[model samples]
Target: MVLNVAVVGAGVVGLSTAVALQQRVKNVKVTLIADRFDEGTTSWGAGGLFRPDLDSYPAEHQSSFRQWISDSWKFYNALASSEHSQDCGLTFVAGTLLQNSPKDLGYSCISELTHDFQKLDEAQIKKMNLPSTFKYAYSCTTVITHVPTYLRWLMQKFRGNGGKVECRKVSRLSQLSDDFDLVINCCGLSAVELCQDKSMYPVMGHLVRVKAPWFKKFVFSDDLYIIPHNDYVLLGGIKDAGNWSRAPDPAKRNIILSRAYAMFPALKHAPILDEWVGLRPGREKVRLEVELIKGGNKKTIPVIHNYGHGGHGISLSWGCALHATRLVQELTSGLQARL
Candidate 1:
C-alpha cells in the first residue's frame, strides 16, 4: 500500500524531511512541492555550520535539543566522511567561537555530542589573525553543508529514490488534501500566512559572499560570523526581526564588509563575490507537531508541521526531519494495515 505524501517548501528543512520520510517509511510516495529551490531559498544563504544555539529555544523545547542535535550530527557527519562527500557539499570543519564576555550559549547539547569540543587556550587564540578583543574562545569540529550544493544533492537523492518534486506555490493545505494522504508543512516563515500562525515572525538577515580561498577555518562572534566554504567565504550578518524585504541593504552590507575586514585584515584583499539578504522564520521554538485537517466527507488529512527553525534550520534539519518521519509512520500505521 503506497501512501501519497506531499512536502511543502524546498529549503534544507523541507528537503531533509522529504528525504527522511522517503527513506524511513515503507511504500510512501513523497512529492516535494515548493515555490523555490536551491539558491532561491533562505537556507541557501545560511552559513551551513552545524552548530546549534539551544539557548535560543525555550526551556521546554530544549528538552529535545540533545536528541535532535545528536541525531543530526550522526546523519551529516556520516555523509561528511563518505566517499561522495564532495558531491553532496558535506565536509568537516574546525571552528572557534570568540566572545568578549563569558556568556552561556547553551553548549551542553553540542558539547556532549561533538567529538572535538573544548575551550581554546590563550596561545591558540593568539595564533589566529583576528582582533585581540576576544576574551574567550571554544574550539570544536563540526560538519558544514554548503546549502546550495547540498540542496541540489538532496533533490537528486530524493529523485533517485523514486521521490517526486513540483516547483510551485501552495495556496493552502486543503489543495493538497484531495491528492495526498499526508502533508508535511516545512514552509518556514510562510507558515504564518499558510497556517494562520501569527506567532511566526520574519527575521530579516544580510550576508556577504567573498572569495577567500586562503582561509580554511571558521570564526564566530556576537554579531558577525565568517565561514569558509570550499570556493568562497560566507560573511555575515544582521538579524532584523519583523523585516520581510528580500532586497539587500547596502548600508548593512557595507558595515558587514567593514567589520569582516576589521576582524580579519586579509579579507580586505579578498574579492567580494556576492551579497544576499533573506528572512529567517522567527519563533520561540521549532514547531514539529502533527495536526489533523478534516476535509469533505469527514476525511482527515494529517499534516506534520516542521518549521520555525530560524537560523538553526541547517543544523536541526535531519534531527527534526527524523522526528517528523516518526509522526508520519504513526499516522500511517493503521492505514498501512488496511490498505
Candidate 2:
C-alpha cells in the first residue's frame, strides 16, 4: 500500500524533508505543496551560512541541538566534497567572525563542529585592520549554499525522484486529511496562522547582492556580514524581531552597504546586483515533532511539524529533515504493527 504524504512549503527545509521522505520511506508518494517558491521564499534570500548559535535552542534541548548542528555540518561537509557540489550550490569557505569582546564570541559549539577553528592572533587582527571596537576574532572553515541555485537544484532532484509539486495555500491541518495519509508542515513563518502558534513571529532580514567576484572570503561581525557566493557577493543585514515588513528599507540598505564597505574597501566600487528582504520564521524553539490530529468523524491524520527554523533554515535543513523523516518512519511503523 502506498502512503500519501503531503509536505507543505517549497523552501529549503520543506524540499529537503520531501526529498528525504521519498528516498528513505518505501512505497510512499510524496507531494510538495506550497504557496510560494524560489525567490518568493525567505530561504532564497539567506546567505546560507552553516553557523548556528547555541543560544537559538532552548536550554533543555542543548544536547539535541548540538547533535543537530553536528549532523548538519557533516551532511553539508560531505556534500561539498562530492562531485555534485557545484550543481547543488555547496562550497567550503574560510571566514572570520569578530566580536567587540572575547566573551561575546560564544562560538565554541560551532568550533567543535567545524575544521580549522582558531582564535585570531594580534598579528592576524592587525592585518585585517578591523575597527577598533572589534577586539576578538576567530577563523574557521564552513559550508555555504547559494540559496537560489541550491533551491533550483533541490527542485530538480525532488522532481527527478517522482515527487509531485502542487501550488496551494494551506490554512488548516484538517484540509489535508481527505487526500493524504500524512502531512508534514514546513510552512515556516506562515505556521503562525496555520498552526495558531502564538510563540511564532518573524525576524526580518535584508540583504544586498553585489557583483564582487574578486572578494573570495566571508567576513562577519555582529549583524553585518559579507558573504561571497559563486556568482556575486552578499552583504547583509538586520535582524529585527517581530518585524514583518517585506519591503527593503532604504535606511537599512545604506547602513548595510556602509558597514560592508568600511570592512572591505573594494566593495565601495562593486556594482549593486539586487536587493531582497525576507521574514525568518522565529520562535523560542524549533518545532520538529509529530502530532496526531483528529479530523471530522474522528479520522486521525498524522502531522509532522518541521518549521520554525528562523534564519538557520539553510544551516539546519538536512539535520532537521533527517530527524523529521525518522519521526515519520516511526509513526508509519507503529500503525503497521497495529494492523
Candidate 3:
C-alpha cells in the first residue's frame, strides 16, 4: 500500500517539497493543495540568491538551520551542473557584497569562505566605479534563481511523477485531515491563520523586474539589491516587518528604484517590465517541524510544516523541502513499524 501525503501551499517551499518527496519516498501518493498557485506565490518575485541569512531559522533550530543550508547548497550545486539547470531556474552569477559594515550576512558567509570570495578594497571599489563611502565589498561566484520559470518547471516535474496538485483554499486543518493521512503545510503567510501561529507575520517586499539582458553581475547595497538574470534584472527591496499590505505603494517603489539606481546608475535605462509585491511568510523563524493534530471524532493527522521562509524562500527552498521529506519518511516509517 502506498502512503498518501498532502503538501499544503503551492509556493517554492511547497512545490519543491512535493518534487523531492516523490523522488525520495517510494510507494507514496503526494497531493499538493493550495489556494493560490504559480505566480500567486511570493517566490515569483524573489531574487533567488544562495547565501542564507542566519536569521532565516528559528533560534531553537539554529543547528538544524545550518545543516539544512549546507545540505541545500550541495543539492542545488549538483543540479546546477546538470543539463536541466535551465529548467531548474539555476544559474551561476558572480556575486558582489558591498556594504560599510561587517554585519552583512552574505558578506560574512560567502566572502573568504566559499569559492572565489574575496574582500574588495578602496582601489578595487574605484576600479568597479562604486559609490564613495562604500567602505566594504566582497566578490564571489553564487547562484541566482529565476522563480517564475523555476516554479513552472517544478510543477510540471511534480505532475509528471504521478503527483496531484489541487487548487483549493483550505479553511481549516480538519479539511486536510479528512482527506490525507499526512499533511505538509507550506502555506507561508497563510500559515498564520491555518495554524493560529501568533509568531507569524508578513515581511513585505517590493521588487522591480526590468529587462537588463546587458547586465549580468549581482550587486548588493544595504537592504536594496540589483541582481541581473536572463529574463530580467531583479531590483529589490525593503523588509517591512509586520506589514500585511500587498499593494505596491508608490513611495516604497520610488525608494526601491532610487536605492537600486544609486548603486547601478545604468539600471535607469532598463525598461520597466513589471513591479511585484509579496508578503514574505515570516515567522519568528521558519517552521520545519511535525505535529499530531486531533480532528473531529478523535482522528489524528500528522502535519509537517515547512513555511515561514521569509524572503529566503528561493534560497532555502531545496533545503527546506529536503527536510520536510525526511520528516515525512520518519512519520510513515514509524507508522509502518507500529512504533
- Which candidate should be chosen as best, given TM-score against the real structure? 2
lDDT of 2 by residue, 105-139 (tens): 25877888787988987888899876545878889
Please identify model 2 stretches exceeding 4 Å from their true place: 103-105, 337-339
Residue 230 accuracy (lDDT) in model 1: 92
Residue 281 CA displacement from its true place in model 3, Å: 1.1
TM-score of 2: 0.96
**TM-score: model 3 vs. ground truth:** 0.93
Better of 2 and 3 by TM-score: 2
Candidate 2, position 71, lDDT: 78
Worst 10 residues of 3 by lDDT: 104-113
For model 3, name the residue pairs that clash.
none
Cα lDDT of model 1 by residue, 13-51, tens digit:
999999999889988999999998877788988889887
Q: Report each candidate's C-alpha RMSD, comma-separated, in the order given.
A: 1.6, 1.6, 2.1
Please give the RMSD of candidate 2 to the true structure.
1.6
Candidate ranking (TM-score, best to worst): 2, 1, 3
